[model samples]
Target chain A: MAVSSQVLSYYSFEQVDITRFRIRPEINRQKVEAEFSRAVYPYITWTDGTELYAGDYAVLIIRSDNPKLCRSGLKVTIGAGLLGAEFEKALSGKKVGDSFSVLWKGETVFVTVESVKNRHKPELSDDMIAALNIPDVKTVAAYQTHLEKKELDEFFFEHSRDAVGYVLKQVQANSSILVTEADWNQTVEWSVNRLAALAAMDGMELRTMTPEDFRGRIPVKSYDELVVLMQREAWESVRMSLLGEYLAKQNGDTINADGYETFLTEAAAPWGRTAEEYRKAYPEAYYLQNEYCDYFRRAVTAYVRKNYFKEEKNEH
Target chain B: MSIKFAEASTFDNLVREDDFVIVDFFSTSCGPCKILSTFLEDLEAELPFLSIVKVNTMEAPELAERFEIHAVPTLFFYQGGELKERHLGVLDEDELRERIERYLY
Candidate 1:
């Protein structure tokens, strides 16, 4: 099931001047400094013979009589509880090549210290940003520009909810794009499934949990009211996404089957699957719906980025 | 107990002493940080056993450096003096509640 909408009459401008909706957000200097500090310590390689400490990235070799525990290259951040509580507590103060057995999940597992990695922070420099190996972001100056662009995009997305609402209202006024009952039902189904998944995470049965019990999340008094509220919210969101899709297409960007297939080929390559394989694995409609929605989002973002600051004047 | 402010000097102590601590690095000028502060206040009132330590990035640059906090509104969840998880943004009430409950029990 795909959400379909058409732009009957285009906006007068080549691109919708997004400047009126844009806000110049303030940047926090300390946050930038901290980010620079993070970039300096992108990763910590194993330092041979170094002792493990709290906050150190530790790699271990498990050598157990049981095949289950014979795993090697188990990485854990000391005091990070990523592996578990006991795994970290046992690794503290341990040096490379040291052998010890720790009780993990009620099983005594033998472990050998493989390597310990500690971040040695460097000064914020082009070399530091380059060390991060982030694509196309090699210099400190480019990173700053990237951060600014990111903030602007964030501001637009966050603040444009109202603007999008206004656009939907205008579309309703000028156009008669039918948001079918099936579309509404699709949204309702999505909400129900999502809420059910969240309930399952808490070990609570969605069918058994009372509305009062779930009121912390959805404030409606009854399940019926909840459905109505969800339907309304979903309708708006679907329209917003479709609108973005419509705008993106009107601006010469391809948000069609061909573009998505090309994107899928690249994405599926990582998983050793071709686009056709992916299509075969899932229902055709499921792929269409997912790809359509993704394209819809990209359309909106592309439209915004291309036109958002197009008319801004130079600052001396 | 409640939301307490921390600097570099007190940051380690707060994380070490408190059984469950959420270190929130924020700035006064940020819009998201402002929104998160209110959520934190409400969260603190609801969950009284945990400590929410607010470290103003402007005041505690050294603390941000030590923790390697990359952004404002960054939350580092610590349990038993060990890092449990770290999140970088304004978490919804339900998500924030879920995280707190996971550690509380």
Candidate 2:
């Protein structure tokens, strides 16, 4: 598929932080919190190795103006990832002033319960629900049961797609320009260090600490073994990047799904495994490869549309 | 009550004393430096065996320049005016503790 012009309009990863500030401060706390909730929260650590916050950098919720919302309890919605689910569970039944720690994005973060606020919980009115569908639901429980099975799934799927779209848009905007080896190295090193910190939080040491001690703390077999696994992961990512660059040069257009299966089959040949076998061994890898291919294709289309197609349009 | 600040002017006097000296060079704006500051403050409270000195880059630009500091935060471990090891950027509290333990003990 050709890259959408909308994808090209996205800002780079470095620009993401700057964009957060562009929102007006006058906006309601709920809206601000909603926006902040979408941000990738970093693991907060004190200088003394104490973790202070486990959830997202920020969180948002809606409730009735009645104080009963505080006493009745709260529900928090997090992303689908492991950390997200964990945060939701941790926040459940938590009252104000309660402090706890949980693994967030692989690192342990400490969280304190902030003040609970009362706000309007937006729901489809009963009349509106009836107007849309003739299903005569009696109680809130029946309506909730109906919504849970289908609507929740649709809502999450839509949000997930939007999040991925945002990242892809960023990648497209950052395309065409070559990243310097220094810049790449810096980013990679920072990622590694962050990973190391996460491992440390899990009580697994990257160096010096014994394997048994590490295993007692983390779910991994050994620190050395984990290091090897991490290295392999990094290598695959780098290899995919090289493949993306190669495809970008050859096609002149982005390599979309039409080229994906062939590319995977050929790429897997060097590893003594068929594409199908590789997919079986690492299903996530296949998904990542497809995504990267799609990104590359979008970048090519974006480059073409911005330069060649625009020029053609101008001529007309 | 004597509130003796860790000033560069007192470096020579501190060298004559019988203690391991740690000079922390840090800027106010650096995240790592800010973290290290709190760490050093905590270390000072807990470890009475050694002297932990802090030098703000804003106030002690001359000392920072003398040390060839190109970064916002740098830690110099010293014993009797001799430099032992230097660390740059953010460090974990455990790591810092171990470093101190190694040097002091």
Candidate 3:
């Protein structure tokens, strides 16, 4: 059965004038120039005595003997400094055309230093711009404008969150859902039990954990207050999840194997898991419901922000 | 639930005349659409007052797009040319009957 049918009524009306949160972002020229430098000739020089060193760019072929290595065989040309502390410790003072072996993160790996060279950051100049081979850009002024415009776009997207946040806050506040008593109890119990589980993880019983034990860490004054906060949190969770679920379905989000796998991969990233592992560990309905919540939030924040939370904008 | 088959050219005309109409947006290749058709037949025999209008979504691409029909076997209920409710998926006989009965004015 659909969530709407179960809820019986989810009267969500009244639209927020998203334009009220209009934002104009200022571009930082220094940052834009740095980004441009990074974008162009990230690693292009080839005159550093062919020695492997920090800040030098090099082509390397990497292979691991460990069968369960994250990436068994990887080869690329990149900045040696970008490789991390483990690599710096092992690869310092090495020479080009040399093959060496090192133990990396518990995995025995082989590295071949194909070529080593120093890459210098180019100055902003018309000559550099001409060398860029960009179709319409052949001057330093044009290049600077291009980088500044790109930076401005990025800044705008970052700052536009206020508009999306306002829309979500307004809709969530205006909407009302019919949560059954059993559902409310289940939500509250589930949230409290998670807290209990956290207490267990820290070798303490939640029932016995005093206010002073929680003080300076959590804002709760007593166990009863904590439970009350948990209930409020649970209600908010349920409300947001239901709204997200309804919005996603109405916006053409469906259950497909490929889409679900993609969702699983992105959703599991913070939890330190692969898509398959997440699928196995997360309960179907729980993750599915959470997916909608995530999707709705993202949809509201995306470039298609004008689509969601529109009360009568669909009028044709 | 008397089945009133509607082509794209006649769909608007069909809905325009009925006081209450259930427009079934379906695809010929859809298995659920086939099953739902049989249930609609039984429903037609049961609820003589119900108006059932079937549109092959495959044959009526424009109509499907206009109604935002994403899935097969979607039903759009109309009362006096205004959309009242939309149900997606194949509903069983009893549930389908119940869904239609409530919309009756």
Candidate 1: segments with Cα more than 4 A from true spot: A1-20, A42-122, A155-160, A168-173, A237-294, A301-316, B1-105
- Residue-level lDDT of model 2, residues A1-316, one tens digit each, is 6431112132333333222212111213443343222121111121311212332222223223333322122222222122257765776555556667765545565666544322222343444334434376544445555544344334334434443445445554454434345434533444346456544544555666566666555455665665565565554344335446455555574533565565545444322234674344334434444466555545534442223211233343
lDDT of 3 at A90: 68
Model 2 complex DockQ against the native: 0.03
Quote the positional error of residue A49 for candidate 3 in Å: 8.5
lDDT of 3 by residue, A49-144 (tens): 577555555556776666544331232223222244566666667788778777666667788877665535445567778778877888988887
Docking class of predicted structure 2: incorrect
lDDT of 1 by residue, A1-316 (tens): 6754444554422233445654445555655654555465433333444887765666678866677666676555665454567777888889988999987656788989887776343457888777777789999998887666666666667766654544335544554445667766876677666566555545566667787677776777666776788788777655555555565666676544545565545433323334565443333333445554555555545555454443445521
Residue-wise C-alpha lDDT for candidate 3, range B15-77, written one tens digit per residue: 867567888887665677888887776554334345789987656667776776756778888
Model 1 CAPRI rating: incorrect
Off by over 4 Å in 3: A1-14, A40-119, A122-162, A195-218, A221-223, A255-282, A303-316, B1-105
DockQ of each: 0.02, 0.03, 0.01
Q: List candidate 2 stretches off by more than 4 Å.
A: A1-316, B1-5
